[model samples]
Target: MNTENDNDEKSMTTGKAQRGPLRGMNPIVTLGSAALTLAAMALAITLPEVSLAWLTSLREALSPILATYYVALVGFFLVFVVWLGMGRYKNVRLGPDDEPPEFATFPWIAMLFAAGTGVGLLFWSIAEPITHFGGNPFSEEAGTPSAAIKSLSLSFFHWGLNGWAIFSVVGLSLAYFSFRRGLPLTIRSALYPLMGDRINGPIGHAVDIFAVVATVFGIATTLGLGASQMNTGLDWLFGIGVTSTTQLVIIAVVTVIATGSVVTGVNRGVRRLSEFNLGLSMVLLLVFLVAGPTVVLCAMLVQATGDYLDSLLAMSFWTGVSTDYQWQFDWTVFYWGWWISWAPFVGMFIARVSKGRTIREFVFGVLLVPSLITFVWIALLGGTALYMELTGTGTILEAVREDVAVALYQTIGTLPMPSEAIALTGGVATLLIAVYFITSADSGTLVITTIMAHGDPEPPRLQRVLWGLGVGALTAVLLVAGGVQVLQDAVITAGLPFSAVMLAMVVGMVRALRDERFAPVPGQKHRLAKEIWTGRDEVS
Candidate 1:
């Protein structure tokens, strides 16, 4: 009867002695984070030009390193996670053998998908493919049929297995150590296999601090992007002006809504909202498939999947060596950085909901299922847009080139529907974007507060509100300074150090799994029995 929800309530109401790091909170980590965030905001506000110059320069200087590091790391994650999922360790449960899954399969997958890539997926599903079709550094010429096909394939490569593998690595490590090994549920705990009790000292504090910084910046950047997209949608739908002020107002309103949800507790607020988002997403997806070139979309899905698989290996390790490095830096590198930066937040949320699942189940569910969903989504939505462009039904490529934020609206407008139907679809799309934004913000608030509280599932309500506002405020400042590009640059930069941390966590996880304590209960017995049977059969 002890569901994940029940366990979460218990963790929150547990006595002070069992509060781990939340009893007083780590002053060093907390204050240091606050000081750095305040300083960044101050500079961005008072010396906007100087801050922009520095951010741009930093990005330029780090582009090569970021590109190389991200490409290699992401490839490694894909291979490593697949091996773990299928290897002998697959049967190792994240918790005890008798522990049933915390939530049912559907809700668990829903929550993970929502928290993992909700807003980013919504923002990019239409825009990325259209932009790629317009032009890419690769050999494919712009606006050609080849470029269109390549566009969907590249979208799949970015949002597919490699991306989710990054999340699975961190999530699997944290869940295994915390739920199975009984460590505190924090980034530091993943290092317990490597650092031992030192995880409770300065080393642990450092890991959690880096996690907090990355999560905040990642959430802030995401919020900025979502606000800009929502503002664009509103302007396209209504007559609202698209300006920084309007975006700021939008951020404020969504942040307040997110804060309210945070106060409602995770079981009620986060879980329910995630489920709702999933439902709405399905409705929107069905609308696109039904209303826009159904037969063509289906064909495109099969073709794109084949193209993606054919190019998977090349794309996985493509660092743009001996080619246009700028393309890799802009598209692939930026995505890798963004995914890594967001991993701590997304991974932690996934870990919270993934208790009691085996390593195999967690790996396949996290890496494969959600990725397949993303593939289908991109194929349907992005494919529809490309089909229109190819058939001369709409000029979506032109609109996407002008402003990526309006790409979704342009695509839906091109559907063979009446004006009223198009307007209704636009309305629904806007509503879906807004809800996705709220879910991301609130979930991020929970993750940040949890890390700060030393992995407490239920941090104080006031703390949640404070971090929620902080995220909103930082997002507003970044938007005013340089808009979505600035936010993107910031996330890429924050990801530099955290990427190293992620690598170390992967090593630690391997070490922990090798320990006898983590071996399956009947693993040795089964091995011996198989070996003896084989020998007897050979002798006979």
Candidate 2:
């Protein structure tokens, strides 16, 4: 009796001790560090000779590795498409009580879109059309009908279905299984289907760590670009010099705003920011409609929509494996690798807010809605720039090659309400960029803490803050040395390791499902407990 009593006492004490490290930490550190890291990296880009060379070499060395990652992503997506379509696997859920989703469907989708794809969408909206108009990078004559149309179509193709598909499959699968199957609601659980027991071992730790690092740099790149451009907008509108100090100031300001939101917790900081960004986006879009060549832009959008539908598949999967190797390398492979690099963070984000959703529903929503919005954005804003460039209305191309931010400003200037338009556009751009980065960074910090602490949701604030500062310091160093482009290259490098990890996650998802369905053994306690809490299954 004494032995049993002592054992019970020891167990209780152990449990209390384990919980001690995770409670009551400051929130500011959790949020500020992420923003700071990105700023540092952006500043680093200013040292073109040293930082650029390092970034380039890092990217080049990782090429073969990234290519393999893309291939694996493609394979994973294809497998899910086949399995789900054929009804080989049923939808799974974790957690009981049918907890409400984190955000409304539209806003949730918008968050994912804005968070992962914002950089490309904004960058290419004006830049791509001009780049394509100059002719296929491989073809002769800048605007040859076949080549030009194909290039635009291909650009849409790259940003369209295939890009989103990779994220959609992994995210939706994980969400469904986690919510339905009583799995821990984290990325590691996504691998449960494949890794089984080993998922709790060294390999699993490595996968999750890779995901954390990838997410840090991936979001950092976006923040660096957006913050730098916001600085340019301030310069154009108010005569502020585009100095490193000014850029750092902008980074500091935005980081504080984001940190405040993050500390407020998810329901307040994250959701409110997402909603605010959406409203701001609408205003910016409205300005584009009212200020720009509304009629011509509309017509171009209609035309592009038609063309996009016609060529999406051919352009997306067009291995072009045989054609102009450089074209494939520069365009197709580059996009594939880019998307792969971004998958883990985006995938994790999707899983976070996507509780209480079905496999089919999550997949379709993530894949289709965001991609469609991107298609329209490019067709509208990018199409307008295309018209301006083609018709000699203004020199959008010269502006872009010279300076990308100026190119956007010049395009906005051509519209009717120039000042108001630029203000609205810049404001929205800054807010969206900042909010998304915050969402990515803080959420990432939170998620990383959870992973490191064995999937605890309310992780230690100290740990969260520590990770946040780490990200910020990394960003600061990179920015101080190289600048935003260098950060971009660093992101590409960071993504390489995570690509393989994401693939393992796919395999884990598959295995977990198979095990639950076929094995005679009872489910694990944690998994079963999650299901009961989330209301996925009835308590027997």
Top candidate, metric lDDT: 1
Worst ten in a row by lDDT for model 1: 531-540
Predicted candidate 2 versus true structure: per-residue lDDT over 1-540, tens digit per residue:
665346333422221224345343212222333344455455564554766777687677755544445545564575565455336343433233345555678778767775557655665666666676775643567754444454456567778777777776656655655555544445565665455546545565566556666667765666666666767777766788777787777666656555555556556666666666666666667767766778876776666667877865445445444554445555566666667666766776677777765455566677777777776677666666666666677787778777776656667766656577567676666555556556656655555555454444565666766666555556556665677666656766666676666567666555445544422112322233323232433211
Count clashing pairs, candidate 2.
43
Candidate 1 lDDT over residue span 1-540, tens digit each: 745456444433322233443343555566667777888899999998898899899989887877788898999999999999998788787776667789889889899888888888888998999989888866447888888888999999999999999999989998987786655678987886677657767887788888888888888888887898899889988979788899999999999999999889778999999999999999999999999889989888888899999989889998887777788988999898888889999999999999989898999999989999999899999999999988899988888778888888889888988999888988988898898899899988888878777777787777788889998999999889888888888899887888889999999888766653334643322221211322332100
Worst 10 residues of 2 by lDDT: 518-527
Query: 312, model 2: CA deviation in Å?
Result: 3.0
C-alpha lDDT of residue 212 in model 1: 85
Task: Please report how far candidate 1 places residue 231 from its true position, in Å.
Answer: 0.8
